[model samples]
Target: MAGESTGKKKKTGMKSFIGGTILTDERISRQFPFVVMLAMFGLALIMNRNWSEKTIRQIGDMQKELEALRSEHATISARLMDASRPSEVAKKVNEAGIGLKEPVKPPRKLVVEDN
Candidate 1:
């Protein structure tokens, strides 16, 4: 009998806790949809902020990449300009002990082929 009374008391206590915390009152309980809707809107705003932050960081990284590419392009262009100069080419050729003599060529006849 004592155990039965204790069990009943425990069940009553559990019911009261649920009824007070979740159900609270008739008015609030009936407005459950409004609370849930507001929560969804809050989450949407947080998700939008996170997405925008990531997008902004990506754009910044892309800008840095573009700058790096431009710098590399400029460096390569400068090197090409330097290498294409006749004076530079002649200097390198002379340093490698190149002679400016013309080579003799032998004449040959071309034969036409039918495909």
Candidate 2:
């Protein structure tokens, strides 16, 4: 009777191979593939979020650069407009001692006859 009981115990001790452990359960091994897949999906989502944030930050930096360039252009354009006025040009020309004078008399055009 003891021999029969020992034989039954030995038969029960023969555990089936469960991956990554010495357990006899087949359920965890069957679900391992799905668990790894879910973890990979979660990692991909995190990476995508990080990449999008980086892109958004780059766009913001470019927008700031564009605004600075526009301000510089406006400043240069205003300076050019002020310098191009006739009064400003006359003053600068006189300051430079160029001796330029404004015309005072209305000139007549000569009439030529064509035969």
1-115: candidate 1 lDDT, tens digit per residue = 5545453322335676677754665555789999999999999999999999999999999999999999999999999999879778777777788775333686678999999
lDDT of each: 0.81, 0.81
Q: Model 2 over residues 1-115: C-alpha lDDT tens digits?
A: 5546443332223343323343344655677789899999999999999999999999999999999999999999999999999899999999999898866887889999999
Off by over 4 Å in 1: 1-24, 98-115
What's the CA error at residue 65 for candidate 1, in Å? 2.0
Please list the residue runs of candidate 2 whose C-alpha ends up more than 4 Å from where it truly belongs after superposition.
1-25, 105-115
TM-score to true structure, per model: 0.62, 0.63
